[model samples]
Target: MLTVDNLVKSYGGAGRGRRGGGPSEPEPDTRAVAPDGSRVFAVGGVSFTVEDGELFTLLGPSGCGKTTTLRSVAGLERPDGGTIALSERVLFDSARGINIPANRRELGMVFQSYAIWPHMTVAKNVSFPLDILPSSRRPPRDEIDRRVRRMLEVTELGAYTDRSATKLSGGQQQRLALARALVIQPEVMLLDEPLSNLDAKLRESMRFELKRLQTELGLTAIYVTHDQSEALVMSSRIAVMNEGRVEQIGTPDEIYGRPATRFVAEFIGTSNFVRGTVASVRGDTVAVDTPDGRLVCSGAGAAPAVGAEVLLSIRPEAVSLARDPHPGAVNQWAGEVLNRAFMGDAVDHVVRVGAQEIRIRSHPTESVEPGTRVHLSADPARVTLVPA
Candidate 1:
């Protein structure tokens, strides 16, 4: 297992540099500043762990510190604080002063760019790491060749062994990159948006392929990406990061279905948020009073105290719409359909409920005409409550 604890990285020295992502872009909220406005923290005390044979993803948007965290784990970037360890080995420790060199850390990394050596053959690319190893640690020539062949087979690139690395298709080159990383048989693999370079269709297909390779090889990997769908589809567990901190960590279903925070509910996918105050708590059910009406959450993980302010997150698909109210529905309200969008397989309708507008997603065939009166209802189990 690989563990990172309270890792911190700052740029331009503490208390001596300007803030923000420069003039080209807005400063990320995660780019924390010291109280005196001295230090610009890129990764502000980020932490997570990847179990053996599991692919844990650091998922967030640009400048959110996901890449920096991955780079720190690969020893490509030095952190200002915190501890990094691989199983029983101490890879880095600020307090103990035990920073391992990147090359000696025995971690494999695949970057956004495939970084394939254009002149080398597929086999050469895969074997280069072993070939350049220190003589004392290098495997015998036959052993190196065997490992290279085995990785190629595992990555489904055995037929491309003799092909020039640059001649392979984008997908094939991606496989070659994975083959090269796997050749080392490193303790952990760090992938930094490895699929971001491919076209959309290829990228989608490769997600499954990469997951297959990771599972079949029983590889421990930490994948970093800004794509929510990618993380949801490929990760064994996901750490949703924003502004340099982990917002929530859980299986894809939990993160998507029951987000721990408003940021998580908004970032993972689309969620309609309703600001409300907790009205009551009974057993597993917690009722909240919103501007529209009372919303009850039945699958609430931990109920907040009564009368506390909170945000109710209802997924677009979770809100059911009908021309007439379902008799005795738990959480139902009358509203006017403001507009709708046909999204191929699904349709999205925007309903104006008093002072608020709630979006509902439904089957394409269920599209409601604009300006029509509709009843918006949600199951108690589908509504999630987030602390305000």
Candidate 2:
């Protein structure tokens, strides 16, 4: 298990002046400075706990501090505050003045670039970490060779064991990097956008392979990425970050279906935002008035008060469009198809309803041409009402 408590880091300090400033010392918290001279918090007070053998992911947009948090855990960057612990061992504690060296932390890391040594063969690259072991504790030469071969075979790189890392393709290099990391047998693996370098198809395949390896080895893994689909497909739980803070943390389904905040609802997936004022609240549902019409939505956490301004977040897949209206639906809107886009297995339609535009997704087989009048309806329980 890994636990992080109130981690914080700032770059510039009194010794480093602003770009055009004179010899005078810069502000104490210059790293946090904004264009207007206000302090910018790269990482605010962030805390989370990951279970043993859990595949936890930190997901967010670029500059959301996901990478900063990962570096802090790896000990490459010292946080100005907070504590980090792995399996009850205190690796970092600002108050206690304890900061373990990165090499002594016993954690493996794989980067987006793979970071393989071009000068070394696959076997040498995987065996390099073992060189740090004390002479008295180091394994025999044959044992080391056997273990390296096993790791290479597990990662499907045995055939290239003697090949220089630079000769491998992007995907092969990525697998080699993983093999090298696993060779050390660390308790936790930190992956920093490891699949970002691969093509779309390869990225998808690697996600499954990485998940399978993590499960098979019962290794605790912390993956960091800005790609929402990657996070959704691989992580047991995702911590969504924004502006140096964790916005929400939950399983993929929970985060997608029941986002805790407006930021999360918009960040995790495509959502049609309908601005309106709450007309009424009934049980878990809330009635809101939009430019198109009144809509009954399933409020995420709590029902908004009547007349309060809110936004209805409706997923494209949750909406259904028909040439004729459906009976008994709590909400329906008549619209003209503005545009249609064909996705491989699905079709997306942009419908213009009065002054608002709503997106709907359907099977590719179901065709709705532009200029056609359509009736759009959704399950009331699928409409999510969030604060505007």
lDDT of 1: 0.88
Error of 2 at 102 (Å): 0.6
Q: Model 2 lDDT vs. the true structure? A: 0.84
How many clashing pairs in candidate 1?
Answer: 3
Backbone clash pairs for candidate 2 read 32-40
TM-score, one value per model = 0.93, 0.90
Q: Report the Cα RMSD per candidate.
A: 4.5, 5.6
Q: Summing lDDT over every window of 10 consecutive residues in candidate 1, give the lowest-scoring window.
A: 17-26
Model 1: per-residue Cα lDDT over 1-388, one tens digit each: 9988878788765544322332222333333455566776767777677899999999998988889889998999988778899999999998888999999999999989989999999999999999999899999999999999899998888988898898899999899998999899999999989999999999999999999998998999999999999999999999988776778889999999999888899999999889999999998899999887888999787788988999999999999999998898899989999999999999999999999899999998998999999998999999998878
Off by over 4 Å in 2: 13-39
Write one digit per residue (lDDT tens) for candidate 2, span 85-192. Answer: 997799999889899999889899998888888899989999987766888867888878888998898888989888988999888899899988888788889999
Best by lDDT: 1
Instruction: Choose the strongest candidate by TM-score.
Output: 1
